[model samples]
Target: MSNIKSSKKHAIQSKKNNQFNKSRKSLLRTLIKKVDIAIIQKNKILAQESWKILQPILDRFATKKIIHKNKASRCKSRLYLKIKKIP
Candidate 1:
């Protein structure tokens, strides 16, 4: 319970931002799952293709400040390594 009206408004805004961030987080996880599934199926081409699709979603999420840039970098790096290591 915010005492000041301004604080109340800030709390409302914070809730809205939290919802938006959660949606973005969900989308990121879904994209990651797509890549992981492709990798598990051992389809190198599919994994590579999924990575290309996932990259933009990741970049947008990072740009919106939903996730850290370095976190995105690490994820993309690991995916690339896995896809490349596939024979």
Candidate 2:
């Protein structure tokens, strides 16, 4: 579809970036779900472990601009509160 050679290259690069971002976001969601499931199960140790894994990934994604900093902080805060509330 792209007539110019540079345009074609750009399209390919864009597609690659799109797939990479998609996978990264999916992984983020999966990790968050794992933490949530642990909380639902009332497993504090599991929740904490998953949180340990997820926290840095959230910060890293924010740092990479894949996700907003506020969003990352918000998720971390809410999840932490939920985990803490689990008796």
lDDT for predicted candidate 1 compared with the true structure: 0.90
lDDT of 1 by residue, 12-82 (tens): 99999999899889988998899898888889988988899999988887887789999999999999888
Report lDDT per candidate.
0.90, 0.98
TM-score per candidate: 0.92, 0.93
Residue 69's lDDT in candidate 2: 99
- Residue 63 in candidate 2 has what lDDT? 99
Tell me the spans in candidate 1 whose CA falls farther than 4 Å from its real position. Answer: none
Evaluate model 2: give its lDDT: 0.98
Model 2 Cα lDDT, one tens digit per residue, 1-87:
779999999999999999999999999999999999999999999999999999999999999988999999999999999999999
Q: What is the TM-score (0 to 1) of candidate 1?
A: 0.92
* lDDT top scorer: 2
